[model samples]
Target: MPQTPLLSVVVAVYNGELFLAKFFACLEAQAIEGMEVIMVNDGSTDGSMAIIDAWRDRFPGMLVIEQENQGVSVARNTGLAVATGQYLSFPDIDDDFKPGMYRRLLDLALASNLDVVTCNGNYVYENNRKPSRPIFPEDKLQSTGVMSGPAWLKKALDSRKFLHVTWLNLYRHDFIREHGFKFEPGLRHQDIPWTTEVLLAAQRVQYTNERFYDYYIHSASVSHKPDTDDTLIRSARHYIKILEMLEAINQRYPEQVKNIPACNWQIAKEGLGILHTFNNMKDPQKKKMIVKEFFDRGIWRLIWKNARGFRLRWRLGRRYLKLKKATRVPG
Candidate 1:
């Protein structure tokens, strides 16, 4: 009889041949045992599959799934569908796991019986060869403790220090499955909304200040790409999708999301920023049409309605008026 693995590491890659060797070496150096790594090749035209196969030869039991070129969300969902471990972590091919990272996370998760256990990660720049910025300040996580999902979210939102990326947290598989948690397909910025839903559903969460993951920042990465009109438009559309996902979750668990109004405000603010980018578009007619799509959708009104307090309402109103004035176009 096969014993269930303690943790599953899911890596979703697209044209990741350049990073596979370093990433595989990082995985090999892990002090943790009883873990399985699942690699999903999302129709890479490069030699990524061959790289994965060579590693599979060296490391037995490494699962590889080949699929058509879907987006990152779809790739992640495919990996989740086949994950057999009690705990799960999603690592990007470009990122490297620090020494003992999973061992520490698994140990904390087991000791606390937590729904989620999260640690800090550092952003390593390709150009800068020095230490990177820590996700959370040292004073903020001076001690380790447990908090209800909702409580932790409130504190995290207030400070704006929450690690919204998927890889930073190790989730209990049963908890995620039971809650019906899955990333929304065909969307960028899926992690922001997915983490929002996960935090609201989590009952017990453990946190530590120790940095365990290396987030590589390079020009080629989607996040670090130049913000051209196309990129801004894509980000704007995705933020709208995320806003919708968050609204559904807020309605499902209103009590768990007392700070949702603040979240809504932040999303709306991003939408406004996206709208402003249209001003930089070369085609004036196209810019006007896209601006109308944002305003005609009544996203601003919905955000104002979501604000729960007088202060929040007043703040959002001021921001809204400013955005409207700055980006006005003839109706």
Candidate 2:
């Protein structure tokens, strides 16, 4: 057996042959010490497995595990089971980090003793597309901010200011293990529930306004695609469960913002996106019926109950969307 590592970098690989070499080239150059790379092959039929094999000699600290094709969640869970790192992080196969990122993150995590530390990532795209607005600055390893548990989530949910992905955070493995938190397996939007649970349980969370991770938005990515029926149902279920989870946390700490703020924004944001997805279908009746059924299914109540913004904005947004739709309606 190889020596124990101080940090475990979990990677869930699925058909990532194209970028594997570039990713490892960056990985091999990390300045961080005592790091182990735990990668799971979710039955990649492509040459991803072969690529890992080739790099095994150079990355002797690398731990590779292969399983039948499962969702990213399962692959992560599998990696977590055997990870010896006190701190943990995951890098999506297509994404790469700048040099010295791992060392910087680990140094901050150890020195600060924070339950979680996250930095901003630069969004890179084809033809030099970057995010319109960024929440964090470039390459900052140390971050400082106010601390709140349930109340913090309420504020983010209230203002509709939240991070959608979980990649940038360096998680304390012990904290996560104590809380018994795991990613929702075989489901879309797994990060939402996982991150929500961790944030709610955190006592000291920090942020670094740095750009260590590079989020490459390829056209084939899920966020770029239109939502299907499965996506809508999955998102609705995820919100419902996450709300229940947050409410339970609120009960324990009711003195915070949880006393009055409802989850309207989450419902509205998630549900309306689903509604917009219905438009792409060729059948008008299908779109209309799905929209009606969404309301009939009592989804709006969840949205209505949890909304944090002014009622006027909701009304205005609803009207604007209607006009946008009307422009395409057949005369």
Candidate 3:
């Protein structure tokens, strides 16, 4: 009988032929025992499948699942459904991790019996042409050692340096399954709400300052794509949805008093992102429609109610008045 692996790394691949070799090389170099890699190919039209097939021999424990182009959420959820490991991680194809990253994380998780363990990483820009910046700078994160997920989240939010990326953390499989957490299908910027909920439900969480992963920032990356009408509208709607989700989470976990401030901070930050997206929209008609929806949904009131500081509240208020004036729409 095959022994259950210690860790399962789930990867969602889409037209990733250009980076598969480097990614595979990094994985091979990890040299970690009892680890399985589950690669979900999300209907790539490129030679991504061919590259993955060729690399199969190098990674015998690797499993591949082919599915239609249903976006990353579905691909990741599909991988999670069949994963047979003690711990789970989701890493991007375009990214790489430092040596011993997973080994160290796994060791810490086992030693502490933690539900989640996270480490810091750097953002490598344009394939390292630009100097990389630490995702969580030294001053941005102060709390260390093992703490409940909600406590960790509150401290991180208080520091104003919380990140929603899932790739930076290792999660216990049972902990995730127990909570019935799954990515929201077809939602852009889904990580924001997903991570929020995960942290809220986590019982034992640990944080390390060690830099592990390299988040490559390239023009081809979805985050770097030039904003268009479609992108703006999608982002605006996504932020609104995130705010709603955060509110729901707060209501569900009412005993997590610490989560209230953290949730409010996240809501304010997402509201700013929505305002920025609205400002960048090219089509006046579309922008007006979005503005109307924002008002109709009472998102403006929500933003004002939860916005933290006076400065942020004032800024949002000013933006709201300006947006209303520009759109010439009724309140």
**By descending TM-score, how would the candidates be arranged?**
3, 1, 2
| Lowest lDDT 10-residue stretch of candidate 3 | 322-331
lDDT of 1 by residue, 195-299 (tens): 877888898998888888889888788787667666666776777666667677788887766555456555655555564665556555555565566677776
lDDT (CA) per prediction: 0.78, 0.69, 0.88
Off by over 4 Å in 2: 1-4, 129-161, 225-264, 284-297, 316-331
Clashes of 3: 0
The lDDT, on a scale of 0 to 1, for candidate 3 is 0.88
Q: Order of all candidates by lDDT, from best down to worst?
A: 3, 1, 2
The alpha-carbon root-mean-square deviation between model 1 and the true structure, to one decimal in Å, is: 2.5
Q: Write the per-residue lDDT of candidate 3 for residues 22-141, one digit (tens) a residue.
A: 998887877878789999999999999999999998887789999999999999999999899999999889998888888999999999999999999998888568899889887888
lDDT of 2 by residue, 1-331 (tens): 8665767889999898988998888788885677888989999999999999999888776889999998899999999898888888877878778897877777777887767777777768855665533534322233456455454455445445566576887788898788877777776677866776677777767666777788787876766777666665455455545554444544554555344353335545665555455545455544555455555556555555555567735753574465346335453
TM-scores, each model vs. reference: 0.91, 0.80, 0.95
lDDT of 1: 0.78
Model 1 bad stretches (over 4 Å)? 129-131, 141-143, 259-261, 279-282, 307-331
